[model samples]
Target: MKSYIISENRDSFLGMKLAGIQGIYVRDTADIEKAFKGALKNPEIGIIYLTEKAYLKIEDLVLESKRKNLFPLITVIPDRYGYERQQGVITQYIKESVGL
Candidate 1:
């Protein structure tokens, strides 16, 4: 089994490739969804890493797969520019966790 990434950032995709992880650099939401589905369908894929942008485009689908406890863990990751919610990201996480 191997890990795959669905990224919208070319730099991040290349960097991950250098680390020996294969991935697809998606240009649009359609491409992101397609790549995500393909990754999910692959039994050889052990982990599916999605850049923030790509994950957001298909958040519901990913969540559904997670709830179903499907194979190949799905994870959301930041891009080359880092997290989109730079300001208050920690705060947001805490708030969500605390239900505040």
Candidate 2:
């Protein structure tokens, strides 16, 4: 399966493209929802990378997808500005699951 990215900025989209991942550039809730739905429907796409800003706009949908399916794992990635200093929710989940 392939990986896809959905980002809110041109720089982030370009960066992921450089890494050989196809992506969508989103500017609003509508774009985010559209890209996300399309990616989920694609059987070849098994993972989705979303920029932090983009994910925030559709956190509920992302989480719901995670709860309902195993493929096309939705991951929130840092933007061109870089990741937040604090621990992220996924990191916390990993730590708890692994007893870290």
Candidate 3:
């Protein structure tokens, strides 16, 4: 069970690489979709990390995958630019998921 990173930039990709996570670097939205689907299909990868910008493009697929699958957990990572979402995003998600 290994963690994979699908980063949009070289910096993020290299940074994760230093941490021993293997992954791909994508440019366009199509590439993002391709890499994301590939990661989901990989039995060896237990977690998938997508850069924030990359994740923003295929969020529907991410959410759909989350609802339909239990393995290969999907995560959004901020690049050098930092988080794209407003503060308390996790809290909001928890509230939404908990119906509160």
Global lDDT of each candidate? 0.82, 0.84, 0.86
Evaluate model 3: give its lDDT.
Answer: 0.86
Question: Which residue pairs show collisions in model 2?
Answer: none
Q: Pick the candidate with the highest lDDT.
A: 3
Flag clash pairs in model 3: none
- Candidate 3's residue-wise lDDT over 8-55, tens digit each? 988999999998999998889999999999999989999999898998
Question: How far off is residue 88 in model 1, in Å?
Answer: 7.4
lDDT of 3 at 37: 94
Residue 24 CA displacement from its true place in model 3, Å: 0.6
RMSD of 1: 3.5
Model 2 regions more than 4 Å off: 84-90, 93-100
Tens digits of lDDT, candidate 1, 1-100: 9999999989989999999999999888888988988888888999999888887888777777776654777777788788986888778545533434
Ranking by lDDT: 3, 2, 1
Which of 1 and 3 is ahead in lDDT?
A: 3
Compose the digit string of candidate 2's lDDT tens values, residues 18-80.
999998998999999999999999999988999989988997788778777877677877887
